[model samples]
Target chain A: MRYVLIGAGPAGVVAAETLRKADPGGDILLLGDEPEPPYSRMALPYFLVGTIDEAGTYLRKSETHYDDLGITFRHARAVRIDPAGKTVALEGGESVAYDRLMIATGSRTQRPPIPGIDLPGVHPCWTLADSREIVRRAAPDSRVVLMGAGFIGCIVLESLIKRGVKPTVVEMADRMVPRMMNAAAGGLIKKWCATKGIEVLTSTKVTAIEDTGEARDPLRVLLDRGAPLRAALVVVATGVRPNIAFLEGSGIETDFGIRVDSHLKSSVDDVYAAGDVAQGPDFMGGWSVHAIQPTAVEHGRIAALNMADGNASYQGSLAMNVLDTAGLVSSSFGQWQGVESGESVERMDEARFRYTRLEFDGERLVGAICLGRTDQIGMLRGLIQSRVRLGDWKARLMEDPQRISEAYVASTHK
Target chain B: MLKSLHIDPGKCTLCMQCEMACSYENEGLFNPAKSRIKVFDFHDRFVPYTCTQCAEAWCMSACPVDAISVDHATGAKVVSDDLCVGCKVCTIACPFGTVNYNHDTGKVIKCDLCGGQPACAEACPTGAIAYVDSDWTGYDKMRRWAGKTDSGAAQAHA
Candidate 1:
């Protein structure tokens, strides 16, 4: 029983470990396009900011541990997969056969189509190499032009501030983290960023990057409406797309990402997809969504269990985003919009830049967002996950998240 | 008679409790990147390396301004930032790459055992790290095996 897993990111590594644990006698092989072991993609910004060293991003257990567990790690790029033959063809024209295969190829950062985009200083925070390259080019007092107000972009913005570099973040959207969070929460975060001396340009786009004559700083970015902003470094936090390019014509069936059933098995037999690549049913809405690390990890674990002959079905994916920026913690779970027709409850203090919103569809919490005081995110997250009814404690939950969380927990006992 | 601080790499999860502890103790903030004791992770190897607080201190000898001195009580090499010229000689002298120069403050920084009690060991959730006595640091491992191997019934079952 040979288990071959592609992409040595978090999902791949967790799947391999889960498979090893479930079936110890089975042979497990983990392959990654990057030359290094799996690292925490979330920590790359911190590394770029000098808050963590280059090697600190590694999340995978050392290579020696993998060897001890009898997991073969092939450090190479997997270019093609033949589902019919049950084989994965490597980039260098080699093939590896597998009885069961898990595709956890994660995602790569999307680079917008703009001239001078191929310049040496342009970077994205999707991989360890990207972080290293960004850090090497960035120095104290370096002006950075970040093109996105997404969670990943804001994280990089915060990291630049920590590194004592001022970042001018240009977002075409009117608000920050628009996809994962609401306008009010985004406004709170934007105000916080302003207080930290970060210049955020909303509803703006970068038209072009002009090469400067100066030797010290080599780039000047032209905005849609404003004058050009001089910058030496640029970090594009503009989201990411699933690494599903290899599945072209393999007949696995992909919309934006590889579509999987509740069992995480793709349309093709003996094949399963998890992590950022698997787009499946929504936990609440039964819609397809992508790019949540926690969901991907859970997908891998469940897929591995079912692959090992254990009965496991992936319920669905809840849209969740957690951001730790400059000592400020922000988390959004479930739906951020009001399309679900939930009774919304909000607690806010504009001066402190703190806000909490709990949207309840009748009595059960459908979605929630927390800012400033995010220590209760874990408690509230469980509530959202369990879909517990707020009932009588709804008003009290707005005042203090802890109180409602406790009452909910207490009710569970009854 | 002096004792030096030792770290067990196997116990380190790279959570950076030590770095935070050191930074907060010295700089009044929670900044690990600025801390003296840096945890180096070999991602491929799954190991973290930190300062060993050597008995024969090379960093102490490398200091031209005599800013880095050996604490008689703890056998720990302490850096006097006021006297440090920031020449970074101590950084070059250390064999283990434990000693580092902070470009922000223009001085060299290294682990000083948190003035005899390390907060990192205290903050560690999984006791992968500990600030043990210099002489008997291996006692924890001995105790672990003792519980497993000491029982006569256990050995018979094995």
Candidate 2:
């Protein structure tokens, strides 16, 4: 069988490799739009921090990984996919036919319409090219105005701090990481950043950005309130949306992303979707796109198994995020925000910047948020994923949540 | 035949020799905190745990850099320290919490089964740990049950 996969990111790469393993003699072709080898976008932050080189961002270290596996890799952008004809049209007016197709075209940065956003010094921290531009301009002691305080923003904030730049973070939300953390948790993060000498402006918006006509610091950031700040560079970390524009009018279904069932099959037969572009089943009983690396990896494997006719059913993607802002680590799992009428318990130590919050639906741990603690953190995912009944341990945990490891072993081992 | 470490908590004395052996073999130190194999004390019972070397390793899959790979000879998921950027994504991806980050080295570490001869099993004084057949980890318990059944059959004949 001839298999064609698009977007050589993590999802595409994993699917290609898995297809090779499952169907040893199948013809597999992987298409990547970028010129460089298959590299991870998640590793771009490390590249920006000068921790790893361009080659280090590669998903496979070996130079002949695809070649050795007998899988063809090409640098081609897919413009359109015709499911009925079993052909994918390329931008250069070329069409490739395939028996099975995978749409792993991941998300792209959502660039908001702000004045002067298309300037030279303003860039989004998304791809490897963006990191190269950021490294070239973001010098030490230079002023940088970071836009948005979501998960991506917080990560870029850490990288900027490591580069010794004087960064002023501007967020439209009331607190940092509004989508990932609750008010209490996000406030603590804001407080922690303040202690580290970062000037964070929450509940504020950047109205416009203008060129200063100066060489040293050229960008003038005008916010809704306060004085205009002079910045050498402005990094946008707003958010991302799936790259499903090409699927329009392709007779493929889409809702925020291409809708796929447990088998990861798209509306059309012989076509499947994975990664950030596929809005599959969520662990909380609905369909939503989980734009995280772990989910992407899981989705790729499951989709490939089904594509190889292995008959694997995905058990939904769990929503999990682990972020290390500067040196403090914070993580949230599943339904971190408590459900309606669900019991919730939280403990906060502001002085130490340690916090723990647990949300429960009946006896099961529906969700949890943890900060300043890394020991046995995976147990939270295990408990929520296993859906193990806590029984008497629920009351014990409400009293002292620190005994989570003990609770996990006792409840799950039996 | 491929072998794996079989840990019996009943025979454990909590001597902590396994931890020291693991650290020395892997890190060239005698510190328990640096040991890949950890013994957890539940106040009543002490249990030793390490990487199970799952057939479908999640840490290997979740790694963005492809730094984690299987050691073909030993079937252990080994992390190449040179390639690791200290991302710590694998630590959270592992559901068992076996993969841990070393602050001193800025790289994550896990059990590599000490090449093929596991140091934890060798240093175990009470036979609580043993390197046994990977395919038949339940052979010992099954043999004991067979002996009990054989004795009952002889008694019935008498």
Candidate 3:
């Protein structure tokens, strides 16, 4: 049967590979818009920082490897999908009929309505080309201005610092990574950034970037309030929106993203959606989520399994964000926002520079954030995943890290 | 005669132990996303690559502030964070693409051989990475073949 996948990203790659594993003779056709072989979007920052070479960014397999597997990977964008006709129309005006189709269109970076956004040296960290452009314009003494202090923003900062670029981050929110982390946790992160000499302006917004002279010289960054910050390069890493406009009038349902059932199958026949573009029910909070790589990976597996006639469900997602800053580790899971009857357990030693907080909602652990000490996080994640009843361990957790550590060790030991 | 971490791509498993160790030492966390010694996996080929630490260092020469210098004890090229300004010249100059900037600390972080005993080499589970004497890395491979041909095989038969 002919299986045509829309994207060549993490989700699409996994789906195609899984289909191959399930059925050897499965005629899998993977279509990608990006010219390069499927590279890790997660590693783009590494490439910018110069730790990973250009060739190193390629995902686990190259284009030739996919060819050997008898999987047809076409570098073309799907302009339209004729679900009624049971065919996918390519950008070159060619149509390929498929027995099953997977839409893993992924996402594009969200650019806010700000002036001078289209100007030179202002970029986002979405595509590999964007990364290359950012690095090309970067200099040792180049004043760098980064808007949005979210996960990608922080990661960009980490990459820049390793390459000897001190970047100033401006967030519209009151704290860094506020959306993912709670106020208490974000406070610690802000303090860490301050200690590292990073100029983090919270509750601040960039209005425009003014550059008249050479691109190497300092460009003035006009803010909503106060004086303008000068920088040579500016990166907009505010957030990402799902790529769902292509599915318009295709009868494929979409809300925030392409809505999919538990099996990752769309409302349309012989079609599925996954990755950052596919919106599914949240695993931990029962809300809709879009941008988690692990969830996308799971979606691919589920889509393939259901397509290959296996029973599987897309078991939601845990909004997990892991960040490693200048000598600091930060992680946030589940809802750090509204917590009903919230109980918190914390272990912090300013001398050792270690801090950990496990947030529990009544009997079950719901959310957590950790820094410096991360060994406990792996276990804490388990507690949240399993929804393990805290029982007496909740009280003991407040005073001792060993209690949770022991529980983790004992559970795993079995 | 600057010392640097020589990665044998054949030995890398992409376990990210080196990244964790590097971040832990510098950033005090186990986040590979922020590590200096990034392990690039050419997934299809299963190759892990890092810095080669060339003799004629482009990064050292390219540093406009002269903050990058050779360590006398280990021969490793070190970036003095205090003296160094956050300029990305060294990052662009390094052909191997091992040098990187940390946004949080506003400094460059390269493999300084981890003071002769590298944490990445120690943390590597597969024995794919190892620190050898600068001049004698190839000698160990030669000795393995020599043992099989000249003495060990013949002695066992006798």
Measured by DockQ, the strongest candidate is: 2
lDDT for A249 (candidate 2)? 90
Q: In candidate 1, what are the lDDT values of residues B1-158, reduced to their tens digit?
A: 44434455566677877778778887789997666655555443223234556543545533433466777777678987655644443543343445665546646677787777766666665675576666766434322322221211122223
Candidate 3: where is the Cα deviation over 4 Å?
A61-63, A348-352, A401-403, A411-414, B1-158
Please give, for residues A227-343, the per-residue lDDT of candidate 1 as tens digits: 989888888888899989998988898988888887788899888888888887776747475576556666777778767876666557767666655556677777657445567
Interface RMSD of each: 20.0, 12.2, 19.7
Candidate 2 chain B weakest ten by summed lDDT = B148-157
lDDT of 2 by residue, A112-164 (tens): 89898999899999888999999999999999999999999998888999999
Residue A26 lDDT in candidate 2: 97
Interface RMSD of 1: 20.0
Residues B73-98 of candidate 2 have per-residue lDDT tens digits of 88889999988987777776766667
For each candidate, the alpha-carbon lDDT, in order, equals 0.70, 0.86, 0.71
How many Å off is the CA of A191 in candidate 1? 1.3
Model 3 lDDT, full chain set: 0.71
- Model 2: CAPRI class: incorrect
Question: Which stretches in model 2 have alpha-carbon errors above 4 Å?
Answer: B138-158
lDDT of candidate 3 over A196-291, digit per residue (tens): 999899999998888868645557899998889887789999999889898889999998888888778888978888888888767553547558
TM-score of 2: 0.94
